[model samples]
Target: MMIRDVKDMVKMYKLLIRFSIRSRMQYRFNFWTGSFIAAFIAFMEFALLAVILSRFGTIQGWSIAESAYLYSVLTLSKSIYRTFASDVHHLEQYLVSGNLDGLLLRPLPVLLVLMTQNVSIRFGELLLGFGMLAYSLGILAGKGQIELWSAIPLTLLISLNGALLLFGIALATAATGFWLTRISMLQNLTEDATHTAIRYPLTIFPGWLKGVLTIGLPVAFVNYMPALYIVRGEAGPWILALSAAASAAVVGAGALLWRTGMSRYQSTGS
Candidate 1:
């Protein structure tokens, strides 16, 4: 059964890849233009931060470089996640039109099928963002703010956690599609919330709001706390362990919610 499941997933992935390539081929000009537009958006976001820093030398005692450090990791993780799980972000359409039934009929996990269903050519935007992130990391290293060797692993972990957090939010949002049949508004709200948190230091917020963003929402675990630990050399083994544990909890909860929603699903079109 395991072998069959693996083979089925591989087949699905191959089909998804072929469809994605063909879609890109059919819309080559649009694909490139979309990539440029994506890149422009990322650049503008970073540029806005620069302008803000110019006006205020520090945010919550975090200098421009420190904020940039966090932003780089956040953006890099977002790019990677968006590139691979674009379908999760836009899952509402599937529920709204009962398209999910197609996935249910497949001999594979519905979530995996959904994940490999679409590939965003717009990841060109993230690739460009990564370049900026690398540059910022280099600047920090030059100032002796971080050691290159140790920073590498920390950065990777931070990025992975960020992706996990985004995936959790997306899965939760997607699960809502079962009830709402359309969830674009919720998706926008979650994405915006993530954007605001990741682009700046969370330390500036009031304690109450911080708690809301931390435990109530847990966005802090995505980037801020992890970055703090790495930058300050204050994170112990337990902190890292908690981050991993938190990610698992979120992912596990999301999966359960998604599966429950699926079980309740009734095809839209009669």
Candidate 2:
């Protein structure tokens, strides 16, 4: 039975992928424009940051290359989440318009269906992130701060965990739509705040803000800790362990919240 269910899931996933691809292809211009705009925005952000850092030399003792590494990790993680879980980011629409009812009636899990609803055209962001990561790694390797071969694997692991952390946050926020019916403002505020906080080294922030980011929201573990260890070559084992634990805890809490929210959902009659 377990094997059969796994096969069914694979089949459903393939079907969803096919439909999503075809739908996107039907609007090729929109897809291209959206991707270009996203990439341009990311480029401008990095350019502005680079200009400021060039004037000041460093922030909180972090060099431009180190800051680039941190930004790459955060950007890559967010791009991955947006690509795979874009529907979850817009889950309020389903809740508000009664579309969630159709998803609930499917044999597969509603979460699975929601996640696969769209394939985001964020490839430009992904490409930019990889470029930044590669450039930063080269700089770090030249400075003898990190070994490229080992750092490659470690960075990939960190990026995956960070993406999972973001997904968990998005899921928990979306789940609130069950009660609020329009949680976009909350979602935007959380995402913006997190992006702002993680774009720089955590040490620059106040002790209280760092504590909140580490304990309350826990976004610090998503990128800052791993980046700190990678660039500084300190606390390697402890950072990895803590990051893993934090990712697990955040994702588990999000899943539990989502289940609870689903139980409270009262679908609109539309």
Candidate 1 local distance difference test against the native: 0.76
Spell out the clash pairs found in candidate 1: none
Model 1, C-alpha of 24: deviation from truth (Å): 2.8
Q: Model 1: per-residue lDDT, tens digit, 1-270?
A: 999988977887778767876876787788788888888888888889888987998887877777777777777777777766778887887887778889889877788778766666556666765776677678778888788898877778778887887788778878878877778888777776766766778877888888877776576777777777776555665666677677777778788889888888877856
Clash totals for all candidate models: 0, 0
| Per-model lDDT | 0.76, 0.88
lDDT of 2 by residue, 179-243 (tens): 89999899877777887789898998999998988987789987889986887775666898899
Off by over 4 Å in 2: 1-11
User: The CA-based lDDT of model 2 is what?
Assistant: 0.88
Candidate 1 regions with alpha-carbon error over 4 angstroms: 1-15
Write down the worst ten-residue block by lDDT for model 1.
232-241
